[model samples]
Target chain A: MIRLRAKISSSRGQSTNISHKVGTWSFSAFVILLLTVIFFPGLFAPYDPLELDVINRLQAPSKAHLFGTDEGGRDIFSRVLYGTKDSVGASMVIVLMASGTGTILGAIAGWFGGRIDFYLMRMVDVFLSFPYLVLAMALAASLGRDMRSAILALILVWWPSYARMVRGQVLSIKERLFIRAARTVGASNFQILFWHIIPHTYRTVGVRASMDVGYVLISLTGLSFLGLGAQNPSPEWGLMISNARSYVLASWWYSVFPGIAILLVVSLFIYAADRFSGAER
Target chain B: MAQLLQILDVNKTFKSGNSKVKACQEINLTIGEGEVVGLVGESGSGKSTLANLVLGLEKLDSGSIKFEGVELEKLLKDKSKSFRREVQAVFQHPLLSLDSRKTIAWSIAEPLVINKIGNSASRKARVLELLAAVALDEGTASKYPSQLSGGQLQRVNIARALALEPKLIICDEPVSALDVSVQAQIVNLFLDIQKRLGVAMLFISHDLAVVRHISDRIAVMYAGKIMEIGDTDDICESPIHPYTQALLSASTFTEESDEGREKLKLFRREEVPQKGCPFSTRCPHAIALCREEEIKIQSFASNQESSCLRAQEIFPNLAKK
Candidate 1:
């Protein structure tokens, strides 16, 4: 999603410009929704997310329990509210780590083409050869099923895609006449790469990165569902789903509600990416 | 001063899967200090490639390019800042050359900033001076490259090239991307700058009239080689080479006159023919001998050379019109 903003702005149009554009509809939609969950989770979540009421467990949707009670007797709606941070935070961490590393490595490989490009691209290919889910699961399982481990595993599995994206962008941007002009004007290779070449590749990288957020969100959910992500008792949508799958037939609200929340957040970002990419100057 | 720059016995080739493109071959030319040498050629004649070679952006396959008797490659190998600061380029596209997001002030001030020439205040002062010289209003400094028109952006590009006070500016079709009406203003501005600053330039364009007006000397390139190079009047008024004659005549094809109408006659030329002689495929008067082998440059008038073999036989007595 951030990649979408990066794509439109060539250089120095980073976070500030994104907010100016996102501030229009996104502040109201994405920011408001996420902030409500982050800051005022209690306002949206009426009942206690952690307090167990096993006697009221498996309760159907009612006025008191809007999303119904789960097998653990925890309020599904309240748990989702609390879980929002982990679900979104994991995606943010992976996206930031992956895209940031990917863009830098890609830019370096593209600008300093030759052996650097060959080795870096080969490494990317090798990483890509491993099935993303399998590799992420292995790392998460090996490291321990924690949020930090999940994020680390996902970042390791994801950065190659961004690196490839940024490398493609940099390759095209470096060939442009402006880069040569920069060199002719006595710009050092570093200056030319950072100031001239890398900035121009932002749009393509931005577009690709923006779309990947949804994919990343889905993958993080998958990781948590497999018990390699936000573990039980955490409100993370994936972990919540994992906790409620046993009672899904009797109380569809357990799995269905968290799924809907994931859908809503993912849709918000996808829509935001589309809207921000449209705001290209 | 001694020759500002010299290219001797240069050659370049690009290999792609089974075939090769001879982009430049045995190209030799010289630019004296304060001289504007216009390099004219159609697209695919390696004009831009030549510009890139001159700018030290590409390596020469063979031969040598020298600046004031020093090897150009060596100067670059030594990372000589003065060599770089002394030479700059203005590309064809206006907006592409200038960073779109950066303010006009920063774009013009970039060279000074990159070379670390002066403090911010002096750099700011120089930016304003460049803007004024390029005839851009001070208010334009605040705007971005996207906010300006094609001509205004090109002016900004020219101003940036001037920021370092370069001794040579290689303008590769700088005005070609602009509208015809805007071209005159920019060309005249270049002439004005050259006269004032006495900066040598290699102004490249396919437009004969545009090049003829600004260039003290004109070098006509065909396929990777210079077919003709001489004083502008010598090439324009008495154009000895067939290619030069064809180009000058073709450039004026829009003039509503019988002469203009007559000069529009072009030989049916293939896009790329498997031939040694660069112009043989398109030369209207090409004979069996002209197609048999490669032709070397044949000297003519003072400061003039033509690679056209039949220059003596075909135009021995062809006087200046």
Candidate 2:
């Protein structure tokens, strides 16, 4: 009976391992396909994203137009494919810049502590007290209606969370005995910060940065949807959705495809971050 | 012998809200060149605080710590690199003393790197030599702290401490965290290193037996004050202070007569007196004078000193035993 039970448990473990492998392979494939879409939209796009065919305007999904045509008779599939760069690429840049700035500021604050920590943390608090979207909207509006302004606004508002997190990590890590050991071995403050303290925060910062990509994408598109980002004719995901709103009742395929594109890409990034964080544990 | 490190009337107090704990007070001690002075105390005895003070990790409130005729504060401010290179430390937890992310070779080479002593090739060679000195194999250098056993990690810590050929090394309970079996090996390794390198050491631990094995002299501390200090043989055989006598009688390795054990009571947790000896509250032979008068360490003909006022009368009886 014991032997039979052992065999059953071993088979169950094998099945779970196989399923895990399958999940990992498919996730990798999806990421590769998304990357290709962002970098070379011309490869899979059947029609010129900007070319118009007014005679077939508002056409539903058909053989010639896989995702049908917008009110301008532009191919929804091609537009969504091209919009990947402006939406997802912009989000990636924003996450990287914010995390980089935050890591440096937080490391300095936590390492020096005292008045420096107090002042820097107060600055972070000032940014954090405001509602993220409201602050981003105000900053975006003041900078004028463009994707660059929207991205800059998001970066300013997003960095404080990273700074706060990295600071917390540094506070705990600085107390570790190895840091004291480093000091006894003649390491200066700067050397200790860079070599001893900062390296320990990388795994945490990397996980947070990956997770922030999805949120930044949603915020960037929200700005575009509100007419404060990407202007018109830019093929940005949120601008495409905003344009399709007028004809949504008559032509559902136009907005639905782009919306699905946003959902799929956002979920993919979040899932990847989850897997990365889990892999270490 | 030339004095290597002198700590005179040093004091440190930690204040949090309304309570104040004196971690070190009027602590006078000296380590000579190529000397091993064991500082043994129970938990909360402030031996670690003194180690931190000598390592320049904490500021002294009153007294001066002179290392080779230079004030500690001046050495730290003007020639910190040289000062740090001359004095290194081995902490209690070996794994905690090493950077977990770095390999053993990198950890050992860190001091050399900071001081810019040699190129990467020479540093690597030095790391190998250090590993062999600690009885660790060459392959141990490539492994991380987590991959090795506690004893191996301690060997790595010792190797790192020895990388700069420091003149003095402060060991803060370096072997207290290891297994009982492994503790002997590490203690022996410290003895071997001291014999070969002739580096001065201030070894701190609560275990008297371990300290006696490796220390040339012994100092017993209680409540941030040294109760007695002398040659290891003098302390073990004729401890004048009631506190030191209790410590020696309590150690498991020492075969004490049942009558001697009965004479010394187990240490009780009593509030330390503010004006008198710190151990007077729990002393087996404390008189009114012990609690009322400010007691100082009294010297004896045997080259030992004790803080107990009655140590002169106590010593002859202890000698007869």
Candidate 3:
């Protein structure tokens, strides 16, 4: 009876494992499709994203216009495709810049942990105390209303969490016996920090960085929706949604398609990051 | 033989809240060029602490350690590359001593690379030569530390330590973590390295038999104090200190009765005294005077020294012999 029960559980586990594999494969394919749209929007987009057609403005979805037309009569499908480069690409850059800054600062702070650590961590605490979006919005508003300012503000707000994480990782890695061995071999403080300590932090930092890309995407589009990021007629997903807010009841396709694009890309990135960190363990 | 390293009246105290543990107290020893001095003591007897002091890993609370006639503090303050090249260490945990992410070749070549001795191609050749010296195959160089066995990783550690052709290598319980069968092999490797490279060593271990097998001179420590130190055979054959005698007897298996073993036992239920001799509470022959007076290591002969108060009375024939 015990063996029969064990057999039932084992088969259940096997079925879940198969489902997980399928989920991971499909997620990867969707990410690849997203990347293709980002890099070469012209391949999938029939109409030019910036072409103006005042007479056909706010057209509902039909055979000619698959995703219909927007406030400026720009094809919604083409705009979402072209906007992938601006929205998703900006988030990627923010994550990269934030992680790069965080890793270096955290390593230095953890390695030389007297007054420098005290001050740097306190500064990080100050940055972390505020709600990220509110602080980012204020900074973006103050820096002037553009995509560059929004990206810069988000990069500033996003880095503290990474800095705190990498610092924690460095503190642990520095205590490992291998680090002491490195010191015995005449490795300088800088050499030990970059070569010995930082290399060990890559796994945790990479996992965190992958996950941050998704969160940064949400925050970036949120900023654009509020007019703090990419301005009018830029074909940005959030800007397109903001433009469609008045005509949503009359022409639902205008806002719904770009919203779907945002949902798909963000959820896919987050799901992929979850799987990536799970596989690491 | 010229002195390669000298530790003079060094002290280190670790404080936790209000209590303090004196890890090393007035430690005075020297390792001459190409000499192997085995330091045997029980756990918490400050053998590794002394190793750390000599390596300049920990801050010295008091006194001085001189290497090649230069103060250790001065060398470390200058961040002297030559001093680092001259002294190296092999820790007890072989696997933990190596960076797991790095290949064996990279770990071994780290010292040479840091010291800027050779370019990449020459460093690769030198790593192969070092692998050969430690009896590891050339293919082992590409493998990660986790892939290697405890014994093989230890050999890699020894190779890395020997990379700069250091004048002294501190082996702190290097083989204690290995299997008993593998222990002998690693000990033999240390002996082989010492013989071929002529590198001085401060070999620290709790196992007296292992220490006696490879050391030229042996120092027996009890509770952070050197109970006895002499030529390996002198201390082994005639152990004047009660603690040294107990250590020697404990390492060697005998068919003695329970009562006999009880007489040979070193530990007593008495509290360790705050001052004077550290072993007085544990000493089987401890008297009232043993607990009252401050004990110092006194020379009994040209090469032998003991801290025990009753060294002369316990072993009267030691001086005559």
DockQ of predictions, in order shown: 0.59, 0.78, 0.79
User: Candidate 3 chain A: minimum summed lDDT over ten consecutive residues — where?
Assistant: A11-20
Report how far off residue A124 is in candidate 1 (Å): 2.6
**Which residue pairs in candidate 3 have backbone atoms (N, alpha carbon, C) closer than 3 angstroms, thus clashing?**
none
- List model 1 lDDT by residue over B89-174, tens digit each: 99999988887767889888888988888999999999999999999999999998888999999999999999989899999999
Rank order by DockQ, top first? 3, 2, 1
* Candidate 3 C-alpha lDDT tens digits along B291-319: 88999888877479998888888887767
Off by over 4 Å in 3: A1-33, B253-263, B269-271
Across residues B42-146, which tens digit of lDDT does each residue of candidate 2 receive?
999999999999999999899999999999999999754799999999999999988888998999999999999999999999999999999989999888898
Give the worst 10-residue stretch by lDDT in candidate 2 chain B.
B312-321
TM-scores of the candidates are: 0.84, 0.92, 0.93
Which predicted model would earn the best lDDT? 2
How does model 1 score on DockQ?
Answer: 0.59
Which segments of candidate 2 are over 4 A away from where they belong? Answer: A1-33, A52-57, A71-73, A275-281, B255-263, B317-321
lDDT of 2 by residue, A39-68 (tens): 999999998888988998988999998999
Task: Give per-residue lDDT, candidate 1, residue B303.
Answer: 60
Error of 3 at A146 (Å): 1.0
Candidate 3 chain B worst ten-residue window by lDDT: B253-262
Q: Cα lDDT for residue B71, model 3?
A: 94
Give the per-residue lDDT of model 3 (tens digit) for A37-127: 8899899999999999989999988888999998788888889889998899889899999998999899989999999999999999999
- TM-score for the A-chain in each candidate structure: 0.83, 0.88, 0.89
